[model samples]
Target: MLDDTLRPAPPRRGGWAAPAALVSVTLAAIAGFLFLMMVTGGLLRWSPLPPGSPADTSGRVSLPAEVGAPGIWTPDAMAHPIPAAAVLISGNTWYADDSEFYGGLVGAGADDYRVLDNEGAAGMASVLSPDGRRLASGDGILDIAAGRRTPYPRAWTDREIAAQAWSPDGTRLVVTSRPVDDEPYAAPESLALLDTGIGAITELEGSSPGLDGWTAAFSPDGARLAYPAGGRIRILTLASGAMLDIPTPGGAMPAGKGAWTRDGQGLLTVAGEHCDTCGDYPVSWTVTTLSASTGAIAGPQYRLDGVYAVRVLGWWPSGRPVAVAYAPAPGTPATLFDDPGTQAGLSGLTTVGTVRVLELTPGSDHAELAAAATESIDVADDVLAAGTLRDGRRPLTSVDRLATGVAWFVGLTAAAALLTGAYAVAQRASRRRSPGMSTGIADSV
Candidate 1:
């Protein structure tokens, strides 16, 4: 107290330290939050949902459901249960509860679901060979066409069953069954030419290499069969008994699903170049005369973009120029469904004489119904070629295609950004406490 030279140091108030520290921490947190908001918001904003998305909102994951048997509704085959084992003429006529199994080929175009063992459906029976003639329908089956009844092989034959198809002449049934039995034709997959006329089934010798499945399609002339084997395009000659693999550019041929051209010269892919998952599906596909007889890729690969689920819109009687229903690229200046009436009239795709063209209208979305095909889906080229096209033919938008891709990326990008920001925030908190622990925070500090 007596020393005048000692002056007290300025007071460092406790309040000052607490406020300053708090302000600094708040500012840091706000800055970090803003940085995160800037990056995360913009990053995911550009994502878009793909076109043609299903009802699934859980992203690509699908949940399984247990449903009871669905009803079988059909005009031709009503008062009976369509066999879960037979070929269904229409998709609407089968059990919704069961997965895709054909209504067994029976009845005057009707049949019951057959069980294996050739006994009553209670027995373990598989698909019967394409038998045109049957006096008594197999258990749970019916008879439709005119054919004599014959007994199936006693022991289960080696033949593997495939999706059924009609031959060009309608005399034979082309189904993808290999060897007609398990022993001789071990290749479990082959296109079998069952001669309904002569009652002889010939296994087409040269398969398009690895081509399997019931998706095997035949041209109307009974000459060529187009199939995808081992993810490549190939054509088989029914007449010549030859299978030639088509050459693709750069790498391998597209392994997408394929359909025949009207003339049977070209094939359509369900997806195309951008569709990596679908293996090249597409809206349009044509097999031009661009290939040599040797089956080489000669001209530009013709394809239409953004279409799927190609149904038999119609067929030209001349055997060329099929009528296909397709929508335009999803977002282009196009309308959806093109009225369900609109059809693409294609020229060529036939060996018949006159130019094979679709009967399209100028202003209307629906196809200009040809006078000949007015009664049915098959339009005769001769009757319609000289026939004029209706006015107002315009293309519609294909909704499903673009949506598929857009939706995938949108979800992916959003999830990525959100997860990234979450990780960043967690890392900042750890850094404030530990200073240098995890590599992520340690580097930042």
Candidate 2:
């Protein structure tokens, strides 16, 4: 009879070959996908999705007068002018311990959309000049109409710079400077005024140590600067560098970046009543005005309800308060205030559901929606041109969709690689245990 061992080893059914092939295929597919995305992104000006019509078809883009003279902005014709009232929208990608943000400029009056390629993080708090021609951020200065950038002066290379606000004439920027190695949430070491025209910096007194996340604002006339520090609002006169400390109510702080009343007399700030012992979350929020000249409360404080938090961005031209409001998502715990230890701030509030830019009128509790987003949204404090409200929600742009797809692809590829490796290991172990099987078959044959 034919030896049973001489059955050709039954063709060695299911070795590592299948798994190895699968691993190779998965790697190749991932590589191809990344390459395709890169090429497509480059060709489409990094914006694969359509950005509605252009706001200005003058076909002539010019640098801000402060940066450069009027002329053709850049060789690339795709760069267009951004409107003054445009609000920045960010879509966030969260990892296990960190997150990345990406988005662009969008306006309510016109469908003017400009994608911010490299300034996704900095652009969130960037301030536009009163004239709406220049945009300033921690990175540098950008010509809103020309799509050009000017780097910060070389003297600032050793320090971290955070642009707080711009002077009324658009020639100067109020910025805070801290050592590069300092914790991001720590208060700034110094505050200075940067002359965008000459690239000069003038340091100011009364730096707020141990208090971070407070934004500074220039009075409407540009004579004084209002900022929160030491649990009070400090007004600094630019000419004499004299400071006035305006005490805030108990358990109250400057809401978002504080804004000056249109008449340049009072300061508008949001105050949150929180019971730290009970929970870090605020129980209620209010939009209150304080006298810029004195520390006393100016007008009646308006209670803002139905929202988790409200940040006073700036005042609309119509004398109404413009703000960005946050609401907790369903199933989100009430204790989910943003961890102050991390740079995530509002963007890291994973439980936040809806974000809306609203125009808060004094008498009515209902806010007029200027723009809305699912993740996060920010508007330049001084750039609410015409104070127009769109009353619409932001749609998912192409960048957001692409980011989501890439994230999924990476996750699946990693999982597949791990499984393939495990299978190969198991197959090798089985072969090692039965080392004599192949030899016996060959001898019988």
Candidate 3:
């Protein structure tokens, strides 16, 4: 028997250690769970299936299998394939692009699509003259009646005229140009004035110094030009080089060239707004008009009901706006790019539907949808061709990328905390089991 005087002390339980570790584990787990949710949410956002496309629980868009093309649809020249750019319908005739490739201009006054045989392979931005006698394309003016080309002088032929709009009088042309193969004019010195009568080329300098030039439309009276840049439409005076900026509503930037109202009092274009609360994808866009004189919003944002992915094409003769809309069966959400944060306020959505012309009428407070665009998967391309392809398609804006980065950081931090807390608890338990530890037990002598 061991001596009574030499009794071993009892091992003391850590009074605060276990409970503190448990508390840490609980808090860390909660944080980690929140972070996990954020990461999953980001992934789901760009998944190919979403609430607005195809068939969804939202019941906005649902279609049968025999409807539009599936994953990828082959485009045909005879059919009105999705227009690659600008669309204009005047008189009884409509002109539109049959493809993005060269010499894709097609025209139709009747139901069938016909190739504009007189169109050349130059791929210049072409617009019909006021009298509708000729098509002015780039530095080369195409005389439809004569079936001949009037080339600009060698001195006037350096720049690639990307976009041009004829003045109401047809004597002047407001042209936007870039390098030869650069489809969208991105250069700072892209604006120029062309005097058609004398072939005089005057380089103008009123475009946004901070942004690349997109769409340019001459005012009805030829006194001003309205174009979109950096979330606003700028009206530049031809005589004084003065400029006025009109901001789009809901902080959405103007997309495409500003479409002039018949009275030239308002400018129309598609505008987009970002939504953070939207689970996977976070952008919503619609078409609206801005008053030229006062910069006031003329109406509510017009969108196709249940159609989330739509791009403004231009206006029709009946005063309706046309757009290319995409709707697929709802599934997972996915985007064109992993993230499209640099595409200035673009929603970064890829569509699978057809073009829609909305019949919205202006009213006292806002515009009302007089008649919804017909849901036709196929339509012949008539009277709506022969201009620069100004389809407003782009990726995400910088703001969207910033939001993604924030979500990732919070998730990572929470995961680290959870892991560290678990490691600390294990270390404490291991220390308690070491041989050097003594138990508080008495030994009888």
Please list the C-alpha lDDT of all candidates, in the order they appear.
0.32, 0.56, 0.42
Where does model 2 exceed 4 Å of error? 1-85, 94-103, 107-109, 118-124, 184-186, 205-213, 255-258, 275-282, 306-308, 328-353, 362-364, 380-385, 390-445
Per-residue lDDT over 1-445 for candidate 3, one digit per residue giving the tens place of the 0 to 100 score: 5433434455755555556567656766655665565455432221221112211122111111111111111122223222221222111011111222222222212111112322211111445554443455553665533445677656645655543456767787766655565543333345677888998877765453212213566665678877655556678888898889887564443333325665678776554445555344454455677788767877445643344344433454565544444342245233221124333211211222223333344421222211111121111112222211222211221113434555675666566656666777787787667655344455775
Estimate the TM-score of every prediction: 0.36, 0.64, 0.46
What is the C-alpha lDDT profile of model 2 across 1-445, one tens digit per residue? 3453522344556566575758757785875676576445531133233334556433222111111001111112125555443554444432111223333454424434555533323223455555555666666777766777888999888877766667777778877777778754534678778888899888764575312223577787888887766777788888898989898766454544447787888887665544444233444567778887776889757665555566666676666777767676655444312224532344234656656667776643756554344445556544464454443333333334445566677667767777777777787788778644353423343
Cα-lDDT of candidate 2 = 0.56
lDDT of 3 at 92: 8
Give one digit per residue, the lDDT tens place, for model 1 in 64-163.
1111111222112222222212121111112222212322222212122111112211000122222222211122223333222343233215544433
Worst 10 residues of 1 by lDDT: 346-355
RMSD of each: 19.8, 10.8, 17.5
Of 1 and 3, which scores higher on TM-score? 3
Give the winner by lDDT.
2
Name the candidate, 2 or 3, with the larger lDDT value: 2
Q: Worst lDDT window (10 residues) for model 3? A: 63-72
Error of 1 at 287 (Å): 6.9
